[model samples]
Target: MENNSPRQRQRRRRPKADVAPAPRRAAPVTGRLRPLSQEDMARISEASFDILHDIGLSDASPEAVRAVVGRGGQETEDGRLLFPRSLVEEALAGLRRDFTLCARDPSQDIEMTRSRVHTGSGGASPMVVDLETGAYLPAMLADLYDAARLVDTLDNVQFFSRSMIAGDMETLRDLDINTAYAALAGTSKHVMTSCSQAEHVRDIAGMCFLLAGSAEAFRARPFLSLNINHAVPPLRFDPEACNVLLAGAELGLPVMVNTFGQMGASSPVTIAGCLAQTNAETLAGMVLAWIVNPEVTAIYGARPMVTDLRSGGMAGGSGEQAILTAAATQMAQFYNLPNSTIAGATDSKIADAQAGYEKALSVTMAVQAGANLVTQAAGTQAGLMATSFEAYVIDNDMLGAILGAASPIPVDAQTLAVDVIAQTVRGEGHFLGHPDTYARMKSDFVYPAHADRQAPDAWLANGAPTINSAARQAAQETLANHFPSHIPAEIDRDIRSRFDIKLPRERMRQA
Candidate 1:
């Protein structure tokens, strides 16, 4: 919040808040190789290849090509290893500079080229919410359906980053593929392979692989990616699941290594200590990945915010969350990698004042600090236990304003008030109506709203809706704007086949 002072204004009154600052930051990047010695690279390369043979991927069943070896038999009942050394490097060689993530609808296609892209979907999974009704309830399928639709309409979403899911693990696999397929069908773009069990991650990766035409397709044009939520096992990977991340890398897939730390949980009371532990794990993962395949293109991710010791859930609404995210952004930039953190996430259940304030602050700080992709951009409540559809909608709007911030303008001419200088005839000098006034003013202004303000009566009149209402409206409007693409019927069929669910007529109609 820049200060608007009369004394300051009198001192210099040429420029207004509308003028954008010059672009100072470079484009955010991902999958970057930190400067390593040739020997180090060799060691990492050796380590990476060794992993393929020694640590094979488990649960790869598509008849995709038995094991990473093509003869071990797909879906090893006893955790079979598929990928070999050569394949990891082979796939990495073909990865592209950038690609498009097809939305469920064609119009929603996201361009993954420039840096600083933020996106999300599925605020909540249909987990067993022992509502006032009963125990072990799944997320509403319509909730996910609406989420996919919301992903289509939200401009901020770069990739269909999955958010929430149904809590039932028994049916999670079906739901995972179901959600991915639904996102593809309803929206028309490539959806993301997301956070599920290790097997499910592999399954989704395979689905994405098939869609792009080959095991290498996603590597070249990876619209779909996944997250390996690292267990902060004292800065170590659970040996069982770490293998999954290695396998994904060998497959030339992108992944978010989200290492979360809660204050009084895995993290200390201080932000720095918390960040250090979290960052160490994140860096170690990337290091191991560089060992696996420097080409894997990892995003150093963290969500090290304070935790509520009493409840043992993430304590949202602390100013430290954004600060930690900002600091993490700096760390990522220091390592020349893209950083992923949260946005539009708050512990508040209903979208009320607290939700609005926390989400906005968390989101804006992350973007401003340079998180390439804000993960939890919308639909966070009750320590991520619940989500509001309306909150997500508002998040989209918030992003429009934030992305606008990324395009800051700065230059000698723009900053230098030439007209003001000229108008200053040495006496009543002022450039209130300078020729460049209108143009400059339009460039850098995020107008205020009544709710964002403390206006009492004004807030009530405008529906006085909670975040739930706003998210619901957002989700509704998002569905109304669904776009479709011309994915080949064969490709569409193959994608659906994996799910063992037939594509509905609605999908075919999407062009």
Candidate 2:
């Protein structure tokens, strides 16, 4: 009964044993795109140093002035704080080049170092698109909590920053406290939030101490950081924000000193001039942070924004914006400091074709250029003026693909599969049924949960759902069901008793 024919033998041959795919874990992807050359970098560095020595930044806080002056900084005749080239270079040399942003859950910690990219949600959008009615509504504390929960479930969104402002809060103090509480209670991921006052920073640190059970414990593993916009463009320091930065630095909280320079508006019209100014501003922040705590984890947040010359508004979704942010990343690399930049802030009011292309181009460029932290990488819309729950779900899919492209491609003897290819050529003429195919299926490919890839017939059978509709449905399902309870109930009660936590506990649970 043995046919002994070549076809029969091939059919009877057994495939190799199936190997399990590696576990899915979020690791940093190294960027490869270089938007600036060596000469450009040297010229910009020199210009920035010149700006620092000559023009100096005005309106430095008393504390910042004291710290910098004690460390060899000078004051201009007009009261501007002048950082000599020597002081700046020494500060840069002493800066912490790498550090970890710890999370409540240890698994979510982000390692910040050279050119390792991580994307997350960021913005202070005042409005959020209503999930049920699709209307722009003033963002509330509940919306921020819900956004954090949504980001917690998204694999590609690495961290959760406060994406929207709690417009309903009566006071800035309440907004800052509740924002931190909501972000922490919603997810165990590392949180970054802005504080309105120095005292609020201490209060939040107190809350963090309670959560971690001790001040030492909280310091050992700080789960939250301060995103201080320390610089106001046109070469000035924000005095209030600088005070907050000093407080955060004293408490040993990791801080991101963001310098947002809008071209043709706050900064010089020319790109080179804009870069030099922003670089000078960011370096000023670093020097201040260094004077406070030489060991503090400070990130150079150089966010160079583009302006539409005719309309005189932010063109966040433009190609110019993409290259500008990418070039900022290069400037950070030039200093050998941990850095962040903004991308994915689309001008489109909604998640549409325009939003897709704009977000993709900018985020891809930032990631490729090796920005350590890519803020506003998801859920932003209308030029960072609003955020949408549906966009969070949709952008999650897009970020995964972008990160996948940034991931390394492996080449080896097993992967080359010369023997397998030869066997296939002599036998089945295909490798579809091979064990390697099954083993590499999940690891090698990233499948989108919302993007439609079905054939026309199958797509029609499924009612031809648009990405927005699918994303909306997915967002609804998540909001309705996914309520995170990482913080223990007893600890939460203690926090509520001590601080004026505004977000209702019931809203954090399923309805």
Candidate 3:
């Protein structure tokens, strides 16, 4: 006989109608609804498996190999590590088939591939020198804010850099806090800034905490994440960074392991040779992530550049970079993973004629190539050096233009704005004031103020600043005008307390 206490008796009385309704899933965006072809899947799977099995690892830190030691990983005399063939099969078998990286703000979320091309500027090469002051500095909190603010205000800019904006961070060691703060200040969507310190993964992990309020927050709405490179040799994982990747894996934050492919240097000069190298390096990292946590989400990417054999300078904005970018993205897809790589970058500064040509070529190719994630969007000049606010403005306009070029013709009844176009053609209709025009123009047409369709004399009267000057002023105004979305006072205080930093008086809330 069961004893029914009063509490148990009361629990049985609850009615089904009083329960909360299940949440509804909104319709997936059109691009998200598209499916991959069998050939598409084959190219991705075959190339990805080849990378996992036959390719050689480069500069895989000492500890990385050791992580697989007893499990059939072998070590060389000089400390290079090698994994047996079985590891490749095991790694690929467990990868999650398909899943959305849910957005923190559900309204902002989109599929891995989307109609709108998301892009941003980045400067994570780990060295910055301020020419104005002739000072060498380390990454700091201010730089993170500058990066975040840069991302916040621009409708076209979609990501932030991971370097100090105004300082020389050549010698800075405490990057964990600096990286963490940048992501926190940036928009509450996709952001990549995890600590390089293993134990301090918690510090970066805390930002992910606020983004969704739980580790489970990552399973659906991943926000803050990390990127780790398999150092040029398959030797070992840097203890600090490895720990962070492990933590991110444990927590389910996404990571993109990008290898810097230096053709004729670290990689073979042949495109095929270089792809094999970069792909192997990326796959090794992906396997490591799975080893750390089965639930970890990872992407494959490379910023591989050809080295001019004589000059040794990286030809990042060169034509070959696009081929490499496209090919590698294909390989990542073979593994059924998302990718991130550089685009819209140039070695030229000042938005000159050369700048326009190089940026357009590089960015356009990557877009048409169908890379999932692309950045190096703005202000990447002199090989991603010497910050120019104007350069960012120019890049913003260019990205908007590039995205416009990528738009497929809308075939739906709404876009057929055929009736509206006809009315305007007959000279009896004012399209500008039309409701249909108002509804569609902003979303479909990206008009540029730089476009001077005026008479030569009228253009001269307007002072005719070059794209450079217009961009410069735009960058300055952007920096001045942007502000973080207002966080609640309690949340702001908690964020500040975590860092032990005080807010400036102007930004502080009234007592």
Candidate 4:
């Protein structure tokens, strides 16, 4: 047993030439597409200001009215709150331009600054595509947790923004709290969720405190943010959502004043008209957030969606939707504010050819235009009506390639490889086994984990597999094996003791 055979000796000395390491995580890529000229942006800004001043908005909560009117906002005879241009300008000037979206793991922190783009999962889809059955089903708390685990393992999905609504949760409070819990338990990445009531904001913050060890600790690096839909399109504010926005701002939680206006339905049919209205609504939300807490981190989330005029249905994956979102990013750039937009919400029910092309087209446009945060960029389907675990796996490969395309290219001496080219020409006649090839292969190329790239013979020998089938297998494997334990057991117990935690521990771990 002690004698080493020839085979064992040869195995020990085998070269590791073919093994390639994983590509580095994508850094924030600079946006280079400009859909709107300076003159176009100026006209849109003026139109937005006029809308805010002339039309104003209705149904502002009493607290919001007081906060805004106290700061020189006027109220029309019709009870609509009007924001003065000067006041809006003042709030914009005072907004916090750059802040870090801290994660449970410090290395995952996202810098919220200029045209540096980031993409992640987001939506409130009520249904999920069953991974095994291939049937559409109601999304439960368990489905949300599993999706979070999938997102946790995804290299390109940078954050989790509560992709699915837990239809099993009966009460709104339970829904709000458990949604946040599932996201927190499922990933160490920065999490974002919505609160049903202002009081529920405090409850969620307390749970975050336990996870971070103390209230001070959580506040120092608050990992959770609220996506507050404070504006209801066509010039109005949702009073309840505004209250939640105020509560979140009071707690110093980073908030996105998200506004969605569907063209030809909730908003004007023309693209410019829709943009102007949504832009005004977004600015109004910012004013309210600034009034409550001047230091609060508020993101300009102006999502102007498109509607299929023929059917009056949401065309979230249409070319019009793509350009509209990119133009919104340009508007945010004009104001020098951190912004977010929706992309890749394919109308296709499954991850088919339609879904693939739709997602790639919209995501490419959004990222190229430089959206600070591109939500709904992964795993969304059926026009944001459904979520798919397998879609997350397939979309991860697509996101990596899109982000890689957006990455800056260097044109320096080292990258030029003049010397390496000359030496290869003189000696090997090719660069296949060259040292520079070995050094740059991993750094320069982004290999797909789910997409296939095999020759015809190899494919036939390996049992020709579709991308969907491969992604399904990958999703099932990851969900069965990966379970994040960033929050300790004792802390989880405390969290359950205080809140109505519904996701069973056994479901979270392998048996």
**Per-model C-alpha lDDT, please?**
0.55, 0.88, 0.58, 0.89
- Model 2, C-alpha of 368: deviation from truth (Å): 0.4
Off by over 4 Å in 4: 1-23
TM-score of 1: 0.67
Summarize candidate 2's per-residue lDDT along 1-511 as a digit string, tens digits.
1123232233224232232323445565675888789899899999999999989999998888898888888887788998989999998999988788888989888889788888999999999987666779788887888899889888888899889998878898898899999999988898999998999999889889989999889888889999999999999999999999989988888899999999999999888899999999999998888888888889899998999999999999999999999889999998888999999999999899999999999999999999989999999999998989999999998998998888877899998999999988999898888888888788888888889999999999999999999888777767666778889899999999988988877667654
Which order, best to worst by TM-score?
4, 2, 3, 1
lDDT of 2 at 506: 62
Off by over 4 Å in 2: 1-23
Higher TM-score: candidate 3 or 4? 4
lDDT of 2: 0.88
- What is the per-residue lDDT of model 3 for residues 1-511, given as tens digits with 9 covering 90 to 100? 0213232233234332222212222222122211345575455455545544444343444455556665676665654456555886687778654545443455545356432245666665333332223233343444455456555555555555453342323322345554555445645445666455565666666655764566666566776557666445322334455555666677667776767768888777877667666666666677777787777777666667777788998776787776666666656655566667787667774567777778888777666656656767666666766444456667777777776676566688667767778878897557777777687666667766443467888878989757665554454444444555645557656766775432242422111
What C-alpha lDDT does candidate 1 achieve relative to the native structure? 0.55
User: How close to the true structure is residue 32 of candidate 4, measured as C-alpha lDDT?
Assistant: 85
The deviation in Å at residue 58 for candidate 2 is 0.5
TM-score for each of the candidates: 0.67, 0.94, 0.78, 0.95
Which wins on lDDT, candidate 1 or candidate 2?
2
Best by TM-score: 4
TM-score of 2: 0.94
What digit string (tens of lDDT, one per residue) describes model 1 on residues 114-229? 35565564345443222122233345444454455555554454455555573422466676676666555545444554544556667777777676677765666666666766
